[model samples]
Target: MATPEDTPSQSDSTLSGCIRPFLTKSGLTVRCQSRVRSQCPSCAELYRGDWAAIARSGVFDGPVQNFRFYLLTLTAPSFGRVHRVPKAEGAKVSRCGCGARHSVTDANLRGVPLDEASYDYAGLVAWNRDSGLLWDRTRRRLRDYWPSVEFFVVREWQDRGALHLHTLVRIARAEAPRPALLGESARTANAFSKVDGAFVSWGEQGDCQAFRADGDGAKAIWYLSKALNYVLKDAVRASGGGARSWGHLARLSTAARMVRCSPGCVPRDCPSHTHTRYGARGHVVSASRRTKNRTGWSFTGMTRKRQRELRSEWVTAQAARAESAPAEWAVGVLEARAGRAGRELRSRVDVLP
Candidate 1:
């Protein structure tokens, strides 16, 4: 005899395919499609891979000789001095600013400030809050100099928990400036905070390297794709420097809480998550958009919306196949057996009456 549990439902079968399924407002079951690795590794990896594909299209889909590409890194201006322990493969320094010869493995003290009381937590919070504006100003400044400039940028968290940017910039070869000049221009660009009127700028440790769309360009794209892993990470949750690091983050959180998010922001009653996430309130990854005068970030026009459409199509096709599978020999056999069992039970009930 077949039990009720053995009965297959179309909705249940389809929903079972997703690791984290949920119901829509109209009662449609669907995958959550979260980008955070902690929430959904499957969707996060897919998101990373899709962006990587779009990034490579910009570099490889067009004429290799007509355009110039550069990988640029911009850092946040220092709010306070902190220990600078080098990584295992990084260049060795004799002594950090704290007058201690720190080893590469001294992870706990690497980004921790020497004087916690004197550290500028408010300034750091303010800088994090205003970093998106700073990048916007920097990009516009670059485009003013070279009209053909297109870019893809990713925001990453430094060991000290400050936000920094990694950008891939593309420009017409005929109009491109020297790599140093471009980097210097971007690094020197400044923005005034709209919320509090404070000046925001990049640190002096900026870098830019030019690479062609052939030969060594493959390595550059690989590097950018690898960096996509950082996009979905939580800055405060990812830090692991022991009690000193925890204390550092706690102070930053407090500062973020007290800081005004916007002109009309009320500190205690504000509903923004910027207060919880250390004053970060912008997208982690971004690219230039297509315009009449420009080709945009992805040369092939790949986008998130397009990816979603393709995914929906795939899901629909799978559902159709599942619906049709009952006509197959194995499923037909199971259905016939269940029907016979059902009739036998009905006959038994009739005899009992």
Candidate 2:
């Protein structure tokens, strides 16, 4: 068996020569010029493959679709926080005082591009399976809080490589509704509270944001592609083993490590740089309003703020209407007005309504 001593130091020339073929093939010769090449080709290959797959797959295609877009980000209740390997430091390492060196147990690794073990695989699977339901419930809540607000559901991956959701909600050019009138029949603020089977916790809650588009398909595709890239494969440790040992050892090692190294360990800077770039670009262009009048607030900005205020007002108005009139009648009246125009426009286009 190869002991830690047998494992080449990261700076070893022999190891570099051994991994030369893989390094060359991966086109990593450029990006890796500054750092000592990783000692383990197997691990390096795993890292290279994951990133390569994302790049090759055109994951950024969606985000590039529209100049203006909206993205709803959701985070799940942590199964528990896990420690991820830092990108700046490369992979983790375990060196004992006795000079006994061990590759950092994969269990200790976390964050993106290192190990997928830090993710809540079970929670992710569950969320993916129940995403449709979760979306429906969330939509219902939003509608109850602001009758005029509209939205649609789409699946998205969180920074931690787990499945979550992106809801494109439409706030139209209509009078503001009360916060009480937004989704189904609950307070707009509490829409998510009623979602059943949702593992809700206050630690990290979900968020919603909108952007104005230049009105192009390319921009929409860009956003979509970027969102899709967040879906990452499960992490596998880098170790040498025969074909026979691959499956069993991979599973056993990761499983054993999960106890000490919490799976689903999103970094403090989770969602990775890919998502961050998209956000930075989106915010730069879309967060502000583009108004007909140069001095007025950007249309997108004004629209978003108005939408919030309207939802609150609409909800309050609806509640008042409900108290004075028949509850069913009041709801019907409000629903009818909300359904009038922007519904179809918001539903069809990727642009924020």
Candidate 3:
């Protein structure tokens, strides 16, 4: 019964430029600037580049000997037992809790719960919801121990859809703790959620490694690039997995929908996408902000605002240069004027004869 007008257009011929673009008040075409790789890869790459520059400034902009940098990783407590499957090639993995040795190619079962009925789906969702608060408490504890600490943290999604944190921590050399001690302090830090008053803590798996900005420049740069890529890469690929993986995600989604995100939230009526995204809500990447008494995350005090201002200045300068140069249309205007003048002269002479 659908006519051509009723049917939606499928052709991409009308689309051009950015996948998501909008007009500013001044009629400038501006992209939506999504940081999610799945939404708009070009904008996401730009987002990663901007953050990478800021992260690099924190490491390389100051005297390298004055500061000590550590890469720290923290994970969420296990909600339940999952398959012990490895994705890397030739990685040694023992028998899973379900009494089977999963191979590297068993991708679909990698994060699937050993027993779906017994898996703590609600607990997993709650932890993801309160993860930001947990990190805040952990960072505060670190600052209490060493007041000179500044950090850049990225939240990444595990194969099981849980959120884990990777932090680039900086401290004055005089106050820096041993890398092992730093990791232990962070791993043991705990918090109580404000929403539902749930106890939150990190997993036992924590690690920290110290690196020097002044060390072999090539290796340092390579490591930095890899870290940035790890942070910016898509958290979850939208692939069609086998039954076990699909069912595991479905249970998580259902748990997310049923849980209360806030004190007054109605689970069924709330419009927040936290329920849809496996209860993950908040900024995935964050850095310490400059304060009156602190150097903050970036030693150079670089920020996204500074980047925007620089781009605006460049655009203005380009416009000025364009206006100063003679345009191609100006030549045509001069030629038309000369032709009109000659015709006028000829007409006057003919009248005189």
Look at candidate 1 and tell me the lDDT of residue 246: 82
> How big is the RMSD of model 2?
26.3
What TM-scores do the predictions have?
0.84, 0.32, 0.84
Q: Write the per-residue lDDT of candidate 1 for residues 1-353, one digit (tens) a residue.
A: 22223334434433433468678899877766666777777666676777777787788888768888888999998878998887785667778887888886687887788888998989988899999999999989999999999998888888777888989899999999899999999999999999999999999899988877777766766667655767777555666667887888888889999999999999889989789878888877778888787799888777877877886677567555545563453465488779999999988995785
The sequence of per-residue lDDT tens digits that candidate 2 reaches over residues 47-165 is 33333333322222233232223455554455434334233345555553324343434323332222335435444333333434445565556545544443333343333434444
Q: After superposition, how far is residue 170 of candidate 2 from its true place, in Å?
A: 2.4
Q: Any residue pairs clashing in model 3, and if so which?
A: none
Each candidate's lDDT (Cα)? 0.80, 0.37, 0.81
Q: Rank the candidates by lDDT, best first.
A: 3, 1, 2
The local lDDT score (0 to 100) that residue 126 gets in candidate 1 is 88
Give the distance in Å from residue 178's predicted Cα in candidate 1 to where it truly belongs: 1.2
Output the better candidate (2/3) by lDDT: 3
As for model 3, its CA RMSD to the true structure in angstroms is 13.5
How many angstroms is residue 244 displaced in model 2 relative to the true structure, after the best TM-score fit? 18
- Model 1 ranges off by over 4 Å: 1-20, 89-91, 322-353
Candidate 2: where is the Cα deviation over 4 Å? 1-69, 86-108, 111-131, 148-152, 157-161, 175-205, 215-225, 228-353
